[model samples]
Target chain A: MESRALGTGLNLLAFSPAILIYVYTFPYFYANINLAVLVLIAVLPVVKLLVPKRYSSSVYPVALIIAMLLVIATLFYLINPSRYYYLEIFSIPLALSTFFAIDFAFAFIFIFEGLLSKRSSRMIGYLFLSLGTMLYELSIIAAMHEFSLTFMNALSLVFSLEILSYYELFVYGYQKFLPMANFQIQINQELLVLFIISTIAIVFSIYLRENGHQRERLGDLAYSLFAGSIMGTLLFAVYDYFSYTQYQLSIIGFGVLATFVAISRTSRKEKNRKPKIK
Target chain B: MIRKTGYIVLGIIAGGLLESLFIGYDYYIVALMILFFVAASDIISFNTGLSRSIRNVEVRREIESNSARKFQMRPIRIFFTNRTRKTVYFHYYDTLSDVFNTEGDFQGYIILKPGEQTKREYSIASIAIGKYKVGPVIIYAEDPMKLCISSYTAPVIDEMIVSPALSDIYTQRSERLSNMKFTYGIHYSQKIGQGYNFYGIRPYNESDDTKYIAWSRYGILNGEDIYIKQMEEERQIDVFFVVDYGIGMNQGTRQKRMYDFVIATVMNASYSIVKNHDGVGYIINSSKYDYFIPAKKSQEPIRKFEQTISEIRPNGDFSIFQTFSRIKRDVKKNALVFVITPFSYPESFRKGTRKEFETNKKVSLFILDPYDFMEKRKDDVYSALMKNSGLKHYRYLTALSKFFNSIGIKSSVSREKDLLYRIMAAYRYGKLTNEGA
Candidate 1:
C-alpha cells in the first residue's frame, strides 16, 4: 500500500509539467510526440483501478488509445491538419540533438540492466526505446532546413518530466503483471511476427525477380537478403546521424544492410547445441 | 528436441525483414534497434553462463510404491534444484502414458531463482491392469523474447504394476467360501476300505486285509463262501486347471482384457482348492509359451500361479482340444479337470474335449466370453449391430455348454466374473458326489 501510494504521488508530480506546458504553449498550443508520452504516463497506472472487473482484459489497450488521442486533440485544436508529422511545431535542432544524446547515453545502462544481469527491467527498456525513438526523430528533423527555438524550453522540460512519470508508471504497472509475463507470450506470436518479416525479405529480393524474366536462384536471393540485413548491425547508428531518412539511396542501401542478423546469432547457438552422431 | 528452439530463430529473421521495410518510414531505424537489442541480449546472456545454468538444472522423482492396485490412486513427488547462479523460468513436463490419469498438473511453467530448490506433487491412478512407465522430466529455459531455449530431459524413469487388489480379492473369496455348502467334510471318501463309513459286503479276496468277517453276511451265505465287511476309504480330490492363452483370449481394451479376468477366475478358484488341502495344478499352452504344473497340494503352486500370470504376455495360437488331450494324460485318474477358455470353438473342439475327459467323469469346462467382462459399446448403429452379434455368439456358447452337460461333463458358459463361483460350486459338487464313484 505504501509503495502504491508513493507511485501515485510520484506519478502526479511528474504529470504536473503537462499543465505547465499547456499554459506556456497556449493560444497556438502545438502537439508533439513527447506531449503524447505525457498523456501515456498519466493514464496507465490508474486504468486498472478505475476500470471494472468485467472488462479487465481490454483496459490497457483502451487506456493507451485514449491517452494518445486526448493529447493530440488538446494540443493542436487550431493547427492545420496538412503538416502532422514527428517533427515539432517550432522545430529546434540543437534541443533535439541534446535529447537524443541523453537517450543514447542512457541506452548503454539499459542494455547492462537487461542483457548482462539477465533481469531485463521493463522501465529501462522503455527508456532505451525512447532514445532510439529520439534518434528516429532527429533523422527526419536534420533533413528539413528551417529550424527555431521558439517553444524549445517548454517542450524539453515536458519531455524530461514525462520520462520521470513513465518511470513511476512502468515500475508500478509491470509488477501487477509480473506473474503473468510468461503467459503473455502467445506461443505462436513469434511465428506470425517472423512470417511478416520474411514476407518483406521476399518482396525486396531483387535477385529473385531480376529484370522480370531472367530469374535468379532462391539461394542467391536468400544470400543477398541476409547479407543486406547483416549490414544493418552498424546500420542504425550512422544512418540516423546523416539524416538518411530523406536520402534517395538510403532506402536501397540501409534496407539491404539490415536484412537479418537476429536469426544469424541465435541459429548458430542452436546448431552448436545439437548432439553429433558418432 | 521436444521444445524445438530452431523455429524461434526463424522468427527473429522475420523481424529483421520487417525492419528493412521500415526504411520507407524513418521509424525503420527503431525496428532495427530492437532487433539489435534482442541479438545482443541473446549473445550476452550466453556469455554470462545462462546456457550452462539451464543444462545443470536437476530434477528427481520419487514414487511411493513400485506397484499399485487397479483403480487405486497414488501420489508422486518431484524435486527440482537450480544449481546455476542465474535464475531460470522453464516449462516443466513429466510424460505419462495413456493408462495413467493425473489429478494434479503434469506440465506448467515454474520459476527457480539462483540456487533455489523446490518440489512439485501430483496424484495419478492407473485405470487398467498392467505395468506402466512414467517420466523423463523435460525442462526448457527461454528468455522473455523466447528467441532461444535451453532444454534438459532429466534421466528419470520409474515403472509400476497395476494389478487387481490381491488382498481384497482374497478377502472377498474367503467371505464367499465360508457360506458354501460342503460335500461331507471331504476327508471321508466312500470307497471300499477299512476306514469309517460302511460299504455292504464283498467276497474275501487275496489282497483284502480283513480286520473282521461279517457274521450276519456269513449266516446268510451259510458258510458257502467267506465274507468280509467293507468300509469307506478316506481320500481327497485333486484339481488341475487347463487354461486358454490364445490371442482370442485377449479381447477388450488394453487395460481390461478378457484374459485378465480369466486369470482372476483361475487364481481365485485355485486358491480356494489349495486352501482346502486338495492338490491344484494347471497347464497353459500356446505356440509362444507352454507351461504345465502337475497337481500338488501346497502353497508353492499358488505363488507360482500368481508370478506366471503377472509375467505372461498372452499371445500366440492355443487349441483347447490339444490342451485337453495333453491334460488327459498329465492328470491323475479321477482327479477333477477344470478347463477355462474364451474361444467359440468349432464342433470338433466339443467332440474332441468330451472324448478326452468326459468318459473319466471328472471334467468341468468353463467358456468365458470377453464382451461380458468389458465396457459396453457406444450408442450407435454399428455398435448396436455388434452387440446383436455378440448376443448370438453367447447363445451358441451356452448351447454348446448344454451339450457337454448332457453328455455327463460338468460345463458352464459365462464370463470371467462368474467363472469363480461356477468353478468353486463344481469342485464342491464333485466332492459331494464322488462317494458314489
Candidate 2:
C-alpha cells in the first residue's frame, strides 16, 4: 500500500511538467515529431520507473520498438538528406539509445524477478511490467510512419492478444490453485472473431499508411481506429460491470440463430433424402 | 476451409448491410474488393502448380537430437525432405501438451523449394513431465490467383521423453560430516558401538580381524578363542514420505502440487541429512517403495536418492495414514519423518492423521500450504466476515492452522505473499528447535 501510494504520488509530480508542456503545445504535436519523440523517449522510462515495478514482460517489446524506430529514422534520413537540414542527424537516434538502455535495464530486473525468484508478488510485478511495456510499444507505433510499421503493428497486435490470453490463464490458474473464487468470464468464438477483426483492421490500417500514397493520414487513422475500438470495448465492459448486463445474450442469439439454420438445413436434407410416396 | 469462408462471408454481409444504410457505394465497393480478393486467392492457391503437388506431398523428417530434461531447454534438429517434384511451403503445428509451455520464436511459415532437404533447429522446454508428440507439419501451396488453398498434414509424429534433474549423494551434507563412518550395506548388520542393543557373536574368522574382535569374549574363553558381538550406538533414521497424488492435487499451475513441492523438499532434506552422517532418507508413495537407499557416510549414495525423488509420479488416493502405516513396517530403526501436504480434508481426517503422527512424535511434519505456493486474489472476505453484512470468502489458513495445533503437529503456513521468505523462516525455526512450536 505504501509503495503504491508513493509510486502514484511520484508519477503525479513527475507528470506535471509533461502535462503542462502538452497543454501549452497541444495542436503542434503533429509537426514536432522530433520534439515529441524526444520528450516521450525521455519521460517514458521515468514514468515506468515511477510506476511501481510490477510488469516485466513489457520491457522487451518496448525496447524492440525503440530499436525499430531508430532504424526507421535512419532510413528517413538517408531517403531525404537535404530535407533533414533542419533536424539534428543524431538526435532521434541518441534519444532512442537511452530509451533502449533504460528499457533493457528495467526488463532485465523484471525478467530475473519473474523467472528466478520464488516470490509470487514479484512474479505479479513482472506480469504488470509486461502489460505496461505493450502499452508503451503501442504508443510508439502510434507515433511513427514507415514500411516497417506494418510488421510492428502486427507484432504489437499479437503481443496484446498474447497478454490478454496470459491474463486469462493467470486468472484461471489462480482459481485452480487457490480455489479462492471462480473466474466467470467465458471467452467464446465471437470474442475470437472480434479479436481477429480488430487485429486485421489494425494491421491493414498500418500497412496502407506505410506503403500507400496517403502515408501522412495513415498514422492518425490507424491510431484513431485502435483507440476507438479499444474504447468501444471498454465501454461495453464498463456498462456490463455497472448494469449487470448479460453480454452473453448476443452470443446466445448467435448460437440460437446457428441452431435454427442447422435444423432447417437438416430437415431440407431429410426432405431431399426421402423418396416421394407414389 | 469453412471457417475461413465464413469469415469472408460475414465481412461481406456486414459491409453490405452498412452500405445499404448509407447512401454511398464505397462500403459496397470495399466489401466487393475484399470478397473478390479472398475468392481469387482461394482459387489461385488451390490450383497453383505448387499447391497441386503439395496435395499428395509426403514431407518426412528424421529427427535426431537430445531432448531436454523437464524444466530445462534443449535444442532439437529436424531434417525435412519434400518427396514431391514441386515446391511446398510447410508450417508445423502440434497439439500442445500440458508439459510444453515454453515461449519460442518459430511458429511462422517455411517455404521448402523442390527436392530440397532442409534442417531447422528449435528448442523446447517441458514445464511438466509426460510424453509429448511433435508435428502434423501443414504444407500450404496456393496458385497465382490466390484462389483455393491446399494444405497437407504429415502422417508421422515424433516422441520425446523429458526427465527431471538429480543430485549426487557424496555431495550430500550428512555423509561429508560423518567422514565416511557408515558404509553402504544391503542388509541390516550388527556393528559394535553403533547400536543400543547387543547380540551374540562368536567368530575368529579372517573377516573378523583385530579391528572388530571381541576382547572380552576372547578373555573369558581363553586361548581356544571366540569373539563377542556388540551393537552400534547409533543407526540411521529412515525417513518415509507419503505424498498425495489425487486429481485434486493437480489443480495448480504445472499440474501436480504435492509432486513438485515434494521433489524440492526431498532434495533439500536428502542433502541435509546425508550431510549429517547419522541420517538416511527413504521415500514411498502409493504401494511402491520408490526410493530405498539406506544412508551411507558417502556422497555417492545420494545420487540414487535424488534420481528416485525426481522420478516420483502422482498416483493413488491421498491417504496420509495409509502411507505412514506402510512406512512403519519398512523402516526398522528410528528416523525423522517429514510430511509435506496442503491440508484440505475435514477435522475427522486430520484427527486420524494426528493419531498416526503420535505413533512417532519424532516426526517433523511440514505442511506445504497450497494457498502459499498458489494464491488467488479474492474479495476481502475476512473483513466481510468481520463486517457481518459484507461478502465473505473462504480463508483456508486460519482453520488449517488451528487444526495443525490441535493435532500437536508443528505446522508452518506459506502464502503467496512472501512464499520463499516464509518457507525459509519456517526452516530456520525448525532448525532452531526440533519442535515446531
Candidate 3:
C-alpha cells in the first residue's frame, strides 16, 4: 500500500476499537450521531481529494473542526433544550470526552506525519489549531454550566488581556493599555483533563514517530512539542488565575516568566553534529 | 513580525466584537488566550538568536590546472569552525567562475555543534583556459524555526589557473607538419648557414668560421686550397595569431563563448609550434584595448602568449578590418598568420583578408562558428530572436567561406569542440600551399 494509505489505515485500526467501545457503552450516542455529524464525517474524504496532494497528508484539522463544531452545537442545545430533541446526549460529559479523545487521536496522527516528513510548520500549525479548539470547547463548557456574569466577564477580560500581553512581548506600542479588574472564575477539571490528555497524545506521537526506523531522524520534534505544550498549559493556568483573581498585570507577567523557562528547555534539545564528508 | 502581530490584533478585535454581539465574555476570553499562545510562541522564536559560532572558514583547491590531454578533477575542500556554546545551523556555498564545470555539491547545509569543526569536499573540472578566483564563502544562519535568518560572508579567496585544454595532437600535428614540403624536408634556401644538412662545397671566406672549414674537403682539394661545406639553412617560420576581440566576437553563451574557443585554439597552436622551435606571437584587437607580442623563438614568449590569451576578455568594439589595416605594415613577408575570428561582420572579413593578402603573408582565415556556440532554442520569443540572428550569422559565415575559397585564400570554419583539429589543418594547408611564396 502507499505510505499515506498505510498511515491512514494504521491510524484507523489503532483508534477505531476505542470509538466502538464508547459507542457501545453509551447506547444514546448511536441515536445522537445526527445527520450533521455524518455529513461532516463524509466531507472529510471529499475535502482531502479537493486539496492538492502536498496538503492531503494531514486530515486532523478537518476532523478537529468537525469535533469543535459538534461540541459547540451540543452546548447550544444545552442552552435551549427544546431546540434539540437529543439535548440530553449532548450534555453528557462522557460523550463529549469521547469525541475530544477521538479528535486527540487524529491530532496525534497529524503530528506523526508532520514529524516523519520533517515539516516543522505543519507540526506548529497542528499545535496552534488544537490549542484554539480546546480553549473554545472550555468556554462552551463554562457557558453550559451557567457560570455567573462576573465570571464570564473575567474570562473574556483575561482572554483579551492575555492576547495583548503576548502582543506587547513581541511588538512595541506607543501607549500601554491597562487590563480590567479580575473576578472569581472556577476551573472545569473535566475539560482541563481532556486538554492535557490531548497534549500528551500529541507529544507522545511525535516521540514515537521519531523513534521509528525512518531514514532521517527528527530528534528536535519531541523537544519542541514538549516545550510548546508546557507553554500552552502555562498560558491556560494564567488565563485561569487572571479570571479567578484581581486583574493585576502580575498574572500575565508571571505567565511570561514561565514561558521563558519553557523556551529555554526547548532550546536544550541536542542538535545533530555535522557528519564527516566522505 | 509586524505583519503577523497585526493580523493577531485584528483577529482579537473581531473575536471581541463577535463575543459581545452573541457569545458572552467567556467565548472572547477563550479566543484571546488562543491568539496569545500563538503570539507568545512567535515572540519566543523571534528572540532566539543563532549563535555566532562560525569562528573561521577556509577553502582549498586540489589541482590548479589540468594537463593538455585529459580533464582534471579539481577537488575543493571547505572547512569551517563553530566556537559558540549553542548549535548553529547554516547554509554555505562557494562561488565559481564560468570556466569550470563543477560536479558534486557546491552548496549545502551544515549543522555545527558547540566547539566543533567541519569540512565539506567537492570537485570541479577546468573546461577552458583562464585565471579565476574561486571564493568568498557565503553563509546563511537561521533559527530552529527558520523564522529569521542572518547572513555573513567569509572573504576567503583562492586563485585558480585553468590553462588551455591540451590533447594528444602532437603526433597528428607532427605528421601534418612532415607532409608540408615547404615547412620540412629537403627544402634548399641556397644559403650556407647553421644547419644539419649538407648543400654544396664553397671556397673558404673571411667570414666563414674555422668550424665549417670541412677538414676532409680541404684535404681532398690538396694542402694548397681550403674548402668549406655549405649546409642548407632551415627556414624558421614566424607564426602570428591575429585575434579579433570585437563586440560581434562575443556572440555566444558565457560558458561557450566564441572568444574562449579562439583563445584555446591559438594557445594550443602556439604550444605545438614552439615545441617544434618556431617563433609564436599574437595581436589582440578590441576597441578598449589592443596588445601586441612580437614573434620570438623561445619558451619565455610562449608562456607570455598563453598568459596574455587567458586574460583577454571579449569586449572589443573595433572592427577586425580596422585592426588588420593598422597592423598590415608590421606583418613580414612569407610569414604564416592565422586570423582567428567569428566572421560575423562581412565587411570586416573582406577588408581584413584583403589587407593580410596585400602584405604577401600566408594568411589562414579561421572562422569560429558562433552558431555552434549559441545556446539551443526553447519555445519562447527570445528563442525566436536567437534563431533569426543565428540564421543570419550562418548565411554570412557560409558566404564568407565561399568567397575566401574562390579567391584561393585558405579558410576553415571551426566549432569549440573540434577547434584544435581545424587549427592544425589550417596550419598544414597554409604551410604546404606555396601560393604567396
RMSD of each: 16.8, 24.1, 12.5
Q: Which sequence of candidate numbers ranks them by TM-score, best first?
A: 3, 1, 2
Cα error, residue A73 of model 3, in Å, equals 29
lDDT of 1 at B89: 64
The local lDDT score (0 to 100) that residue B103 gets in candidate 3 is: 82
Report the TM-score of candidate 2, chain A only: 0.23
Better of 1 and 3 by lDDT: 1
Model 2 regions lying over 4 Å from their true place: A1-278, B4-7, B10-72, B93-105, B125-232, B245-261, B279-281, B284-305, B308-317, B329-334, B344-362, B375-437
Estimated TM-score for each candidate: 0.54, 0.42, 0.56
Candidate 1 reference-contact recovery = 0.02
Q: i-RMS, every candidate?
A: 16.8, 19.7, 10.0
Candidate 3's residue-wise lDDT over A84-137, tens digit each?
757666443435435544444443344344333332234434334433333333
Tally clashing residue pairs in candidate 3. Answer: 3
Model 3, position A191, has a per-residue lDDT of 30
Candidate 3 residue pairs that clash = A182-A247, B68-B166, B287-B317
Ten-residue stretch with the least lDDT total in model 1 chain B: B1-10
User: B1-437, model 3: which lDDT tens digit per residue?
Assistant: 22332233334433432332122233233333443444345335533545334433333334434332224677777777776776666778887776667787678888777777787788877665555667767776543333333455666667665555545223225545542432344233444577777877788888888888877766565666888877766565677888887777766675666666676567667766666566777888777668778888765665676666565556656575565564576766456777877755655434334434454566777777777777885769878888799787777777777777666667776667777667666555544443222
TM-score of 1: 0.54
